[model samples]
Target: MNETEQRRATQLLQLARNGDAESLETLLASYIGYLKVLSHSQLDPRVRGRLSASDLVQESLLEAHRDFTKFAGTTTAEFTGWLRKILVNNAARAVETHLLAAKRDYRREYSLDLLRQAADESHARLNSMTAVHRRGPASEAEHQEDLTVLSNAIEKLSTEYREVIVLRHVEGLTFADIAIRMNRSAGASRMLWMRAIEKLREAMSNENHE
Candidate 1:
């Protein structure tokens, strides 16, 4: 992060720790986009209509705010990890609540462990998109920043483009699977995937320039 970002993060962290709700909200806002992408990528496809990614992230953030006093972590990494755990747990609960209550018979149920595994796999794929050669704390920080940039870029994409890219990369779905999920032919899904990659590259370039 830049010096300004670091200073803002520090100030927000301190204020949030002191029971400042607005500060906590501001801190969480910085990550809302990232969390949305994670939630979308990991959400059970069968239950997506009933569970929105934004809603899930909001619910998780609310829980985090309510239990702020219980958090012991002081660093940015620690904070991210803590929030990720909450998001994963909330997602798992959401799937169970919506799927079972709705009485929909799916091929599988989303256990907490499975949710976490999916999140980890998606995060790994996200990290792979911004691969760096070095290995150290500095490299890790750069990687995280790159991910944030990429996430923002993805968020800027059109829904169709974003959906295709996320399914193809983050969820590791094949063209046939994505086609079925998107209600498109496999050839059309491949075409959309290509377009999405082109758009993603353009978005990243624009972000870099800005």
Candidate 2:
């Protein structure tokens, strides 16, 4: 994270902890986009009428706000890690609830086999296509299309794997920053990240071959 982001995150965390609702929302806004991906990755996109990403993010924010006082962190990385944990947990709960609701509404449990199958198909489509994104308007359509595939691939990855890939690749965070974000020792983060990259590469290779 940059110095500005680091300072702002600490400020927001402190202000939100002090009961400033605006700060809480600011903090939430910073991470909402990623959390949306997190939420979507946990669900079947085919089931489009389900809970919205914003709803899950709002739920996460509510939960985070409730215990903001208990948060004791000074750096942006620390705050982000905390926020990531809360967001992931909230998303997991929302997914569980969605599955349950589906069962009640349709009289059958959500299908795990179906979800896994969807994830695999998503992975395959992502592999056959290129993955790219431009930072500014100068980017081409092909770049955007690449990004979409990569984004989907990132989402379908497991939680631990997803975090590593996004932080290291998509977000372009340093190993140190990722280590901080994951609240792991620097050495451990590096090791895990290497393995995660290998896993992603294997997935991509398999995706391309098929």
Tens-digit lDDT string for candidate 1 (10-76) = 5677788888888787777767767888888767766678888888888998888888889898866
Maximum-TM-score candidate: 1
Q: Model 1 — TM-score against the truth?
A: 0.79
TM-score of 2: 0.41
Each prediction's total of clashing residue pairs, residues at least 3 apart in sequence or on different chains, is 0, 2
How would you encode candidate 2's per-residue C-alpha lDDT over 90-145 as one tens digit per residue?
54455556555555643233444444443344333333334322344423323323
Candidate 2 residue 207 C-alpha distance from true site, Å? 32
Query: Which residue ranges in model 1 land beyond 4 Å of their true spot?
Result: 1-23, 102-108, 132-140
Assess each prediction's global lDDT (C-alpha) against the native.
0.78, 0.57
Best by lDDT: 1
lDDT of 2: 0.57
